[model samples]
Target: MMKTKKLIIVGASGFAEIAHEYFDADTEYEVVAYAVEEEFLKTDTLNGLPVVAFETMHQRFAPQEHSVFVAATYTQLNRLRARLAAASKEKGYALASYISPRAFIWRNVELGEHCFIFEDNTVQPFVKVGNNVVMWSGNHIGHHSKIKDNCFISSHVVISGFCDIGENSFLGVNCTIINNIEIAKDNWIGPAVTITHNTDVAAFFKPAKHEPASVNTYRFLRIKEE
Candidate 1:
């Protein structure tokens, strides 16, 4: 078994609070501190752990003896985490990765640091996921797919085999990317949109909306919304 460390989590509030639960359940981390971006901190002791000053956390808990994880969510999860990661790396602290015990990952998969893979996600063989990525619930990451750094993927999204998603993209819920396609950088694919071919860089796609047909002559109270 891997030994536990006296840990500190950056981004002490909001979704970081929610992520604390998973670490709390695992024996691999003996969480000892929480730190934020200075402006949002309020006297420490998040979930009973001391909220240490960000700048002095290393002095108090040296990096060689302890490690840090950035727990911020996807709204600004990538950018903020990347910033703090640079800070920690300079101070000799290692960025942590968390894969939920309930997630299913095949052999030969490569995941970079600071990734959070939540429950019910299937990462197939020969897949590669880059740094600071967040894979939410029930995602299907097909064989040989590559998701670049800093991407946010919502629940139930299907990334088919051999597909490549560029860096910093946002994939909405129920999004489907067809096999062998490439979704370019900074793209925003809306929920339930099926991507069938290679998308241009910075492409934005939205679900198609249809107007309701004329009301049925016999239907009185069940008309569509205005």
Candidate 2:
């Protein structure tokens, strides 16, 4: 397929590379270049594409012709991505969203710009996904659930119906949010956590650290410790 719409990804990190791969393979947007802040600009090319300075990228790829996608992770509680996205828009670049063809999105689901929904994600009816939201693969966003702006939802999360995930929150991999739960803004729910009740603003929920057995595994299994 001929990809007519040009796209510039903001960032040169691993996540940015992944975003390039996804957009190139699945979407109509042809990722032409990668952009980063001048202070952090290192390589001239990433994934065979030119790595340009974000400050002056618009000069080469005019915002009127090219769109941008900020491929930042949950750094600084998603503030970095949000800031870059806002800056890109201020530069007159239209924010591009990528919804995987493999993902199942109900007709009533409302997805905002700059959002990235990966494969195997099931966004049911009445789900409202806000801008700059990143939903990794294999998540189930139930009916009437609202994932606010700038949130990063890791893989295999199960958000039940009527849940309200607040803005700038990071839902870790394998986390489960029960029905009717409201996760407050800036909350960090760590891996394997199960949230059953409403969370306060800026709440941090992490799974208990694993305690290894006192006996060595080699000794227990009667094997040599190499």
Candidate 3:
């Protein structure tokens, strides 16, 4: 039988716990430890494993024997995740990728290292997902779409065919990128918004504010009195 590769997750927060669960359950990676910055190190243990300072984690867990996954969210515009991913590579640790079994990824699709593709994601043919990209559950990535590195796609998003999402972009939940659209780098697309064409670099797009309905649900139902 093939032995599973030991891994150290680069975080200790809730997202790191989720990454640990996914990598443990679906992949061949055995999470051995958690690593965070010295200043952020509050606890000594997480998920029953020793939490070490990232500065000296390499000394404890040799990179030649262990792999790493930066289990960080899209905070700081994904710049922090990108920086950590690069640092892990520099430390001679091979980055890991996790694709959920419930996700439908085509055979021809290309996924880069350190990617996290969650359940119910329908990644069609000819799709290329770059490194450090996070696709939350239930996103539809149409054919010929290319998601660049450090991009975070939220749940229920629809990226139609021939779309190109640039690096460090964040697409919020329920957003739709129409066919032939190219979202530029560092763009932040808010929830429920639709992009029909190309977007400028570092642009922030959000849906219009929604007002409360004048009639409540109880009033609209009009119940008959006895």
Global lDDT of each candidate: 0.83, 0.96, 0.93
Question: Pairs clashing in candidate 3?
Answer: none
Off by over 4 Å in 3: 1-3, 223-226
Worst 10 residues of 3 by lDDT: 217-226
lDDT of 3 by residue, 79-142 (tens): 8888988998899999988899999999999999899999999999999999899999999999
Ranking of all candidate structures by their TM-score, best first: 3, 2, 1
Instruction: Write one digit per residue (lDDT tens) for candidate 1, span 83-109.
Output: 787788898988877798899999799
Q: Please, what is the TM-score per model?
A: 0.86, 0.95, 0.96
- When 1 and 2 are scored with TM-score, the better candidate is 2
Reference-based lDDT, residue 37, model 1: 63
Error of 2 at 81 (Å): 0.5
lDDT of 1: 0.83
After best superposition, candidate 2 residue 80: deviation in angstroms? 0.5
After superposition, the stretches of candidate 1 with alpha carbons farther than 4 Å from their true spots are 1-3, 207-226
